[model samples]
Target: MKKVGTMLGNIAMYFGVFYALLYLLRSTYNFEVTLSFAKFLSRNQAMFMAVLFTLITLVYLLIFRIKGWIWPHADNNLFRVAGFRRLSAPRVWLMVGMGLAGSLFSIGLIVIDDIAQLFPSVPALVDDLIKGDSAVYVIMGAGILGPTFEELLFRGLLFRELRKVMPVYVALVLQAAAYAYFQPSMALSVISIGSGIIYGSLYLRTRSLWAPILVQITAMSTIFLLKYAGFYAWYDKLNEGVLYFITAVCLMALIGGSIYVWRTSDQGHDWIRVAKARMADTPSAAPKGG
Candidate 1:
């Protein structure tokens, strides 16, 4: 329980730092300059957010390195410690395929009034956030950079911390709950909980942070692409029968993709085992001559 409290505190600390810096940056200018800058930021909100996320990601990485939280010591590499080891090419494709399938499945659910209808305003909020934003900025920020930071924090840092004191399943739910707790809206919170569990399980299954990161990037980018291509507008024109058929197909694909990912996932070896194997093969880790 104490460890869980500390984990929550860490999450709070990260966000607290983020918002504090944001406030300072936005308020540092003189009144007239601040007003003008605020107007500019409002217009280029997506781009500004991307830049801010990039800065914060770098800052956190540096802090973790210095504190030995990510890097640990001179003997350890940051990427390896943080679950960035290479995955097989085939598995990579499977992970991405599953992610894409899941995205389409979500869309089908929304179209069929199976999910998004539960949170009535989420669609409008999403539209407002992305519809008028610059395509490049929105894709870079929300699709790529945003997921990178989140996966690094939740599945990478927070998950590691939780795993030290609890079983994997317990850690999974706790971290997922923490992720959801920070969301700005109830609808997003609900969605975040689900996505968080998926991402956390992906991390554990693949034993690599890249798994969830790639999957999330694929899912979010696909959604944004459909939105930009006016897929929803076209969907509305379809008759109920056709819509139901398409959604059913998507549902089947989602189930198939999930099965593929599960079957192909490298569950036999965890990061620790892989690292030990690598070290055992290294000449430096061999026994010294008498």
Candidate 2:
């Protein structure tokens, strides 16, 4: 029964957000325009959606809490899994490097598409969505709200619940896969999965939601700026021949550098050990001062 309820909760959360977004787009904008705008939203509006969705989910969670379906204090430990430890300089640098590498990997795909003349339709659609005065909407939706809510739900809550049913790696993979599927863009779907892995790994290592959230925010911000400045389109144009090859090499180098920094960092071992350890410790080491 508990498993069934939990499964239902997962399904509800995922489909609820999907339907909500679909409804928002359908009711708020023309299908063609909304489709086009989705790309921009992905780049810009994602954070907004994330924030809205997370808040709505929190409300639902609260409702469950009030009904005695779930207890806030009973599962308080799960919510506090994002241990509030400060990251060391080495870990910080390592995460930044990894984040850059992840960005490069995403860009490298675009370069490949350019070389093959297989550019995705999503960007053009996004471009269409922002064709007029509503451009600011896209910025707010993507830049701020989406990142915050997504981290809160996906990395923070969803994964925490999942850890109860599946192996850590399996749960991470499943959550990441689900997250990727929501994007509705093959490239982004792939990127989301990869990012899920990185973020999930970080969460597991540090037992801190902040680490993944920070990385996600940084990534989304970079994407927003890139799109706002036409860098995405520019790169799409350079997707062929020598430039693409050079870009790919650079991306690989970036990945290698990030891995090196992460492995050598002091917090790297700490995170790794924590991730491997059982979920025995609470958010803090001190006794619950009841």
Candidate 3:
């Protein structure tokens, strides 16, 4: 169908163009430019790439916006927090909380695997991306830049477009699949797809990119920091009893948070405000309002 082809083509183009631009910038900084630039890049590959890629992606997004590309506007309702805000606020805190909870949930899956070995080990590429990278680079890339671009494209633009034609759940699956496809390894791909489902659902309910962005940033940063701090190493050394207990606690938090959101989301916009709005919309409450 034309719809499927358009979606796939859009995915391919986004990645293709992004990588092409990144490669071009990197190649220029490495070879086409001065020797000092090349040395700097060679020395701080990951961090430098994150900064550059994030910068370029932002610029590309700007250009697309100016040109009226097939994308959602960042100034719209979904992007109220587009530019990181100056004031420390409650919504920001909420995003951090949701992000932390979501991260714990996803990593719980891996901890479960460590105990059971039911899943295959992470792919070599995924392992390299995870364990081999230095702290500064990993934190910048995975924590900040990665979350920014990914949320912008997937939940911000792509999902918006898909929802126009298909059901929200269907769009969530399609975008999740797209998200998974871009990951390094099969294991990560699977995990990302699962995570995408949760994130997409949250986005649908919350209508704010910040919620999922925070979740993503926290998830990635926590995983990287834990790996750096040897938490996983310590986890591996734990006996089955402790492992099971930790795993269960994480599962509970994950599932509990998910259920709370599902049951209490009140049609998905501004949780603090949703409750009053929900009550006001009920027939009895409507009569009271009159």
Candidate 4:
């Protein structure tokens, strides 16, 4: 129970610091963005979030140094526990394929009006950036930086912490729900929850943050590029039957490819070894609180 409380506290602290930084920056810049809680998440969120995460990461690293907190050796450090490890070339290729298919599959989800209604800001932000002559920056920020940081926070920190106190399956669900909590509407929440589960599974199954991070970056880049090419406009003109057929094919590819990867991937064995090492070290690693 104590461990659970500490985990929960850390989750809260992460998001709390994020929002506090957002508020501070907004105030410092004297941006005319509204002060209302409802409007706090402006459309420029991706760019600002990237900045905030960079700042937070720097601060945490500095604090760790000042506190003389030496990271554990390679197999036991926070980075290791958070799934920051490598994968075989085949596994990496499989993850990239999965990401591509998943992004294509997501078009079906996006066309569901209720599910994607609240997500317009993402494309809108991208469009705005492109029009402002910042296309490259938006891609780097949204496609790479944004997804990397999210994977670090949600799949890395949240899922790792949850695994310490519960079975992996339970932890997966809890972490997914926690990730979805940031969505503003129930429909979007459901979508995010589902996405979180997929990313979490990728993280655990591959035993490496690289798996999910690559998948996310690939998916975001694919979608953004498709959007930039005006594919969505062409898609809108398709007959319902053709659209359904394409969506079904994409879903089949995603599901079938995912199953293949899950069966063939050997990285989970590494995670099991890491978990055992963690269990062995837990007692000694606990703070003395003297």
Candidate 5:
């Protein structure tokens, strides 16, 4: 019974958040109640929702700590796990490069508007919601709130927990799939899922939640800027010809190459050391040398 309960708890920990999100969306957008809980949420309570979700994630982390379900560190270096010093220059640069690459890919899709057409429902929904004094709500939701909450939950909590139960690759792919399902636009869905995988891999490699958080925030901010500058719409009008294809390909290749180099270089080794050290500090974690 204890084993069954643990299994159920694990499943609920991951999928329950997702279920809550779906319920929030459906109740607000799909049904037509006079009070329109969805409108109310978008207008007045979006920040509350974001904070609530963040708190839920923190609670899960606390529970896991109490249960001794934490990862082991590499060398028993307490210094590596607790402070900003663990964040190295290479890791930061790698995250920035990855973020830029993701931004370029998303921009290419937007340029053709091929991405927007994938989710014909979203623009109308967005337009309707932004009609009143709530225009800033869209910006806050997408740019700040969504990235902060979603990354903390998915990359910070879910991926870390999943690593304890599954192989790293399997954990990353599953997280990415969840990210895709949550996206409102299909094109954005693909980008989100792909970026989720990248972020997951970085987290696994670096063992620092901060790395992925920075990347996610940067990517989201770039998207918001493009949208605000009208570059997204203007790109749609340009010819989606050979030049555009070449440019996209080249940009993607550069980004991928940068990530590859970073992962393969000495900086990657330092991050691995830091991760192992952090894992060692948890109560249930084995000693670094052991």
Candidate 6:
């Protein structure tokens, strides 16, 4: 039933975003201009949908910004997840380094995918999309706003909600798989799932959303900037020798970072315990006095 509710929430979120786009289309643009823009985007259907999706999702995020906070705390009057919680600057920076390490790991997956021809090329698709006037829209829409909203939904809501009824590990795995499966290609799926785990682990450790949000923005904005600047061509031209070395470096970083996260943090020890405590505790009850 909890899963069902989550499914509904996911559906409603997308629908809300879609409706906002429809409303904007009807109100913000005259029919003739709208027709012309549609025709223009029709030149690249993939980018048209991507831009439209991002804009709609951004509008949805703006509308429910307050409500989004409310849900995290809805578990108890004490939402330690993000709203009322924060990490120290030093701790946040530690996670930043770890998350970037993970980002390198994800990028390495793409590089390998390119070599193996394992999936459709996202860079090529973005190249098709990021032309002329749409560049700014794609950058802001897909690069920045899109990722923030995903974290809001996946990290902020779904993971916390799952923590209520299930074990922390269970919630993490399920959420990670869902995140990966929703992405465009198998290669990206692998990368997304890997990122989802890192993000989920960070949230659990710090009980703060900002850490993962920062990491996501860093990874996504870098990729978007690269695409915008036509840097993927240089990436494409890189010899297999360089690709192998970078992939090995990324793998080592990922392994080392995961070790650091596990051994150096109490979050791993607290993972299941925290969920159990929160799950057993109820909103109607008073928060325990420390």
Q: Pick the candidate with the highest TM-score.
A: 4
What overall lDDT, based on C-alpha atoms, would model 3 receive against the true structure?
Answer: 0.60
Per-prediction TM-score to the true structure, in the order listed: 0.77, 0.65, 0.70, 0.78, 0.66, 0.70
Q: Once all C-alphas are superposed, what RMSD does model 3 give against the true structure?
A: 7.8
Q: Give the lowest summed-lDDT range of ten residues in model 5.
A: 75-84
Once fitted onto the true fold, the runs of candidate 2 whose alpha carbons sit more than 4 angstroms away are 1-51, 54-72, 75-86, 111-116, 125-139, 230-242, 249-290
**lDDT, residue 275, model 1:** 35
Which parts of model 6 have CA positions greater than 4 angstroms off? Answer: 1-85, 98-116, 132-135, 229-238, 267-269, 284-290
Q: Give me the candidate number with maximum lDDT.
A: 1
lDDT, residue 228, model 1: 85
Candidate 3's residue-wise lDDT over 204-286, tens digit each?
Answer: 66556666777778767877677677776676676766767765676565456555656655643454343243233333322
Candidate 1: stretches off by over 4 Å: 1-13, 25-31, 68-78, 113-116, 131-133, 241-263, 270-290
lDDT of 2: 0.56
Q: Each candidate: how many clashes?
A: 0, 16, 2, 1, 8, 0
TM-score-based ranking, best first? 4, 1, 6, 3, 5, 2
What is the lDDT of every predicted structure here?
Answer: 0.67, 0.56, 0.60, 0.66, 0.56, 0.61
lDDT of 1: 0.67
Best-to-worst order by lDDT is 1, 4, 6, 3, 5, 2
lDDT of 1 by residue, 1-290 (tens): 66457656866767776887677667735477577666655665555667677777767766556656543332233355457867789878877886687667656555655456777555655565584347887788778887787887788767765665566677789889989987777887887887788778777767778888888888778877788898977876777677778766765664565556655675664644533443333334211100
Error of 2 at 62 (Å): 3.5
